[model samples]
Target chain A: MKTLSSTWKEMKKYRHSYLMIAPYYLPFLVFTVFSVLMAMGLSFSYFNVLETPRLIGWQNYINLFLQDDIFSIAMKNTFLFVAITGPASFILCFFVAWVINEMRPKVRAAITLVFYAPTLAGVSAFAIWKFVFSGSEYGLVNAFLLKAGLLMEPLTYLKDIRFILPILIVVQLWMSLGHSFLAFIAGLQTVDRKLYEAAAVDGVRNRWQELWYITLPVMRPFLLFGAVMQIAQSFGVSAVSINLLGFPTTKYAGRTIVTHLMDYGIIRYEMGYASAIATILFLMQVIFNKTVQRGLKRIGE
Target chain B: MTNRLNRSVGGTLFLLFFLGFLGIFMVIPLVFTISNAFKPLNEFYLFPPKLFVRNPTLTNFTDLKQILANFWIPFTRYLFNSLWVVVLGTGGHVLFVSLAAYPMAKHDFPGKNLLFSITVLALMFSPEVTKIPNFIIMSKLGLIDTYTSMIIPSLVFPLGLFLMKQYMEDLPDSLIESAKCEGASEYAILFRIIIPLVKPALMTIVLFNFTFVWSQTSGEMGGGYIFSEKLKTLPYVLVQITQGGFGSMQVFAWDGIVAVINFLLISIPIAVFLITQSSIVETMATSGIKD
Candidate 1:
């Protein structure tokens, strides 16, 4: 006891550094590490808070990948959502940012804020999109079409699988435009204005030529960064879609992998199956991140 | 000379079209939300939608009040709950992230590199996958339905820590070493030397976190609307209002409430942030520039 106490007192001599770090470090370890380990453990068995986890081995994973139709839908839809929205948002935001960056600083800030305003709409506007695309005569889009003398009847935009995915894509595009747009704008500002002046002196008459010669080359890292971020973001579509459109509407078109996990975990209390779905999502995201990183490095080099 | 004139006209037209599209895309929804709020009950069903309200009255506002009364709890309580989470969550995040980031920024502490890697990896794994386990852990902590549960789980601010670390790394090492050599304690160095220098980054962190946290708290993810209606946040309340939680006659009325709250909740902070330190946005953007 005396020896241990002496050792502890000696350790206290360097305690200032650790104490400075302890507040952030200790809580992070507990919640992040401990919580994550508990989740991995939960995947091995059938445990809800109500009862002891029954050991189930690989049964949960097998059923999830093989038998669960909803899981399959979730995988397909989520990937498709990521594929479409990710690149489109990036290109569009980059284009806008590039244009805005050409303007004076105040004008650039004004345009940037104008683009950022949609994000402020948050999910509330998305909910309004439900009304906008509502199937009935009450729907704004349908009502517009009807009054335009274009259509004989109202279209059920949310219900059909065809329209559901497009609706989700458009909404995602609208909300996501601002943040990455800001990121790209920030990236654009870093380009040396001297590069453009030199290019113009060399008789680069057009914007496209300037972009190829000056902007893209200079802002490659930021562009790659924005692209990867968009990919990560578009794949993370579960929260917004799930909130706006509940699961299993018109053949489960809107379900994403995260929503699938949420269904099993939160609503169904199937902790094991949920964990399995999450594990797959984690694996897939890891692959996507790696591919993008490789792509960035290759482009950079 | 004529060809040059034509090209200039074409360029201007292209800019106008592009800028116009972006403007409409951003503005229409805001216009829609505000327009819908003011639309009379009969106008809600009108085809092609009335662009402007003919009889704009306090009726929707009055109806919103009546509808709010029908809720299991008062609408203002949800507003307060949202405000509470933002205040505490933002405070906790700003404090802890700066605390953790300052040492990592200045000191060559052991395991700093490893700690940084962990934080970066944490950002990749979105909260979606972790929802189940996090929920279970929250339940175990007896925080499932409380305001603390909503705020505490996300309070780690790993992203903020990384941002703060990146920002603080830009500072000269001599700034801190001088303080240390002056017989100032580590805490004193952090409090006196570090925090003051990182004001722009601090503002950026606060702005981004405020918006992010505000948006999240308004959703079902925070369990903001599930139980204890009094504890529901503004977004959840808006959801309820939209989904007809207030009953039929009061739908437009409730829409007004949703509008007012959403506008108030977001615009107040944004206006304050933008108005006071609009310059910060440019500075932060430039600071973020890698040169």
Candidate 2:
């Protein structure tokens, strides 16, 4: 590392560059960077909204792991979500973008919109699924099953512990083709067409061979980006869960770490405990992303 | 010849079939939401829950208007609040992110790599990790219950900066070098040369920020910040009305109105996206994250 004096001198030399970045960076430091540091620090203290934080050592972390049953369930469910949705969405996005990339430009744009509209609609659109899965006899799925004699009675899909996680997974996947998908589409367009001709001349026989040799390596950067986006999203799957199945679902069935954090931080106002949960989640994502980044570097090698 | 070598006809057909199947799942919810908005109340409760309305009516729209009219604050006030916040938030975010991104993409500055690394680190985690601390900071700044609380925090989106930097890097150094040799000011070169060249990236930023800020007006971002009734926004009010703000009992009778409001909430962003989709595609084409 450079000495502090030399670093300061360099900053002064590029003062114009510093000036350009300050408007955005200063607020970013206060809002994002400082908040992250404060959360990490607060995880070790006991602070409710009404009182000053009292240093409590590792009490929050201990309680979170050893004593809290609900936290364990939340942890399990969060891992399940990240494991399933993260890779599923990442591969699905790349595949869908690859398929559509071969279509005519006008047709491609329309098809992209079809897949992307759900994400663009944000969380509010998830309400439509409520009607489809509504518990009453008049609910779409229930009514269809009843008419078809497939079920003896109406089923409340959202409330059923057996179905809640699966349904959440499906809905999450439905909206999963979001930012990364768009990035993939853009990345696919950048792959030079001439590479395929060159590869074919080199005796590449089939589409899979071409993809393995040419496309995957060429798109590695985007694949890495898409992986990070999916990891972040799948780990933070609270809004859709809360919107669909209420905050603490049946027996906390669909409760993820984020919902658990919300339970403490927002409702109970146990800022210290919530920070511990947040720090765990933050660590999980960073570690997972680092691993994925390394793995993506080996793609097509 | 290259196309034939790269893709078999059977492979193309199979992929199309798979796409078509997935497209059904993707499109049905949207179609159901739209069709339900026009469904008469009786059709809403029909046996077997019809996907299409046999008799369409505007009663849901009229009911929404009536519910909104009964609010203590005028509906237009919420509209104005949403409009200004979205405009200012989206515009400021794009401008600030792009300004910071230019130097990081093109210049050699102290701590540049460190700042960019922090940005990548930030991108790995979601905002929930920092929500409580951000709230504390907002309260400390005396920005609570104000528009600044909403607009100011969103001005430095890392995704926008990352994308902008990537797009800007694709531009050859010679372009900027030539402009510099002519003794042009940094501001002039940025505004006259760089900005116009990077329109696709700007469009991408604008579209993403617009969708984000539009949805945020509904109290997701502003829920803790803005407490006053008059300071509330259109979507927040709509959510309140549909999710039993007036009363849960009344909401049961207004299912059609809820669908109508959901349609309105989602369509605006989708429409804005449709208008800017082409430019976004262009922007993303160069948006690869190079090390």
Candidate 3:
């Protein structure tokens, strides 16, 4: 606390610089960073919608890990989502960008738009998936498979835990191609064509060799950027769960830490439990980011 | 000649395969969304689903017009509310981000690295994780259920700041140095010299922010922020209409109209993307992923 005061005094000397940055950092502190800290604080206290929060240190965290079965299930499901979607989508984005990077400018634009359509449609627009996989025979999946004689009966894709997570993964991947894909496209364009020319002279006889040795090294930054966005987007899988799988989802198959947070925060009004969920989710994100960043260092090697 | 033909055949086949996969997963669903907007009511519940409309009709849109006519606050008000909010939010975000980004990108100020680091670290956690605490903060500041609540939080998008900073770093330091030698204040350097040079980056911010805020109006996400009907946004109203939560008519029975409404809601951002395609894609390419 004493060091904070000293830093404040020192900050006064460069107040203008601080002031210039304040419009962003100040609101960011108040809205984003402060709220995050407040969430950490609130995790230690009990508060329903009606009452003032009461101090109940460690109870929420204790119950979250030990007593709450659903939280564990949510964690497991969330890990499954992140594990499956993050790497799969990142790899997919890179390769697609590589392929598209070879096309003429007009062709590249059209293909990029085709791939980027869903992302532009936004999360809400993904509600189309609900109708596409709707339980009724009128649903797109049921109609096609049945017409093709693949199934005698239409399965309830969203309601069935067996199919929900898998279907959710598909829709998640579809929307996941947005920010990272464009970044890779742009990054690929930024990579010098002369490098490939030089690599060929250096005995890089194959496209794979060229990609591994030149393209990958040059686009490492884009890969890392795409990975971070992928990780965050995949881990933060609430809206898809809620819209596609239904709230509290059947057998808790679609439940993730985020949906659980929403369960407590919005539905049950258990602010403390919800904040605890938020904190744990935040901690998970921080850990994943740190681990991936450390792993990126080895990419150049 | 045969060898060249063989290689070209293989490449064409690969392209076909890629397009086939994308067509099934990406293209068809989008085609469904657009075509289904014109679908007839009976076509919606048909035993076998159809992708293209059998008979195109304007009934769904006319129904929408009727519904819009009956809204207590009138439909144009919601439209204006959403437009102004997006304009203000996106406008403010582009300005503030670029202002901060100039110093962070160009200057050798104390704690600059730390400031840049905080924003980068903040990126890993989207607003969803902190929505509850943000709600609490908004309520404490009496901003909940107000336009300020939405606008203020959005004015400092972390991604936008990082994007601008990365772009501004590409600007030559000599540009700012010469201006400084002439006794121009940091503010003048930023407004007069820095901004004009970084117009493309600024356009990128505007396009991205517009799409983001435009899409956010879908009531499921942050619909809880504004309670008053007049303050509500277009997408929020679209959600309400789709769920049959608004309007007294038996509109839910008409899935075609609801689908049309959903299509209409999503089209705005798509238009914005097409308009600013170059900057958005180019800016994203320049977006470096690591420290």
Name the best candidate (by TM-score). Answer: 2
Q: What digit string (tens of lDDT, one per residue) describes model 3 on residues B164-199?
A: 998888888898899989999989999999998877
lDDT of 2 by residue, B1-291 (tens): 125565688988998899899999999998888988999878877797877779989999998888778766778998999887877788888888878988998999988999999998998998889888887888888888898877875686788888888889899999999999999977787889999999989988888887777666664433557777777778877877767764222444378888898899889888888888988988887766665
Query: Model 3 fnat?
Result: 0.57
**Listed models, DockQ each:** 0.41, 0.71, 0.51
Model 3 C-alpha lDDT versus the unseen true structure: 0.81
lDDT of 2 by residue, A1-301 (tens): 8999998998888898889999889999998999999999999999897889999999999999999999999999998988898888888898899998877898899999999999987756778988878999988789999999999999999999999999899999998898899999988988899899888899998888988899999998888888889999999988778888987799999999999998999889999999999999999999999988998899877
The reply for model 1, stretches above 4 Å from the true place, is: A1-15, A198-206, B1-12, B69-76, B224-226, B246-291
Cα misplacement distance, residue A239 of candidate 2 (Å):
0.8
Q: Which candidate number maximizes lDDT?
A: 2
lDDT of 3 by residue, A203-255 (tens): 88666677788889888888877877888888898777877777889989889
lDDT of 1 by residue, A1-301 (tens): 4597775675566466677777777877767766667677778888766888888988888888789888888888888877888878888887888767656777777776667766666656665677678788767788888888787999888878888888888888888874456657766766766777777778888877777767776776566546545766777786557656666457788888877777777787888778877777776776787677566555424
Query: Interface Cα RMSD for all candidates?
Result: 5.0, 1.8, 3.6
Model 2 Cα shift for residue B107 (angstroms): 1.2
Model 3 chain B scores worst on lDDT over the 10 consecutive residues at B1-10
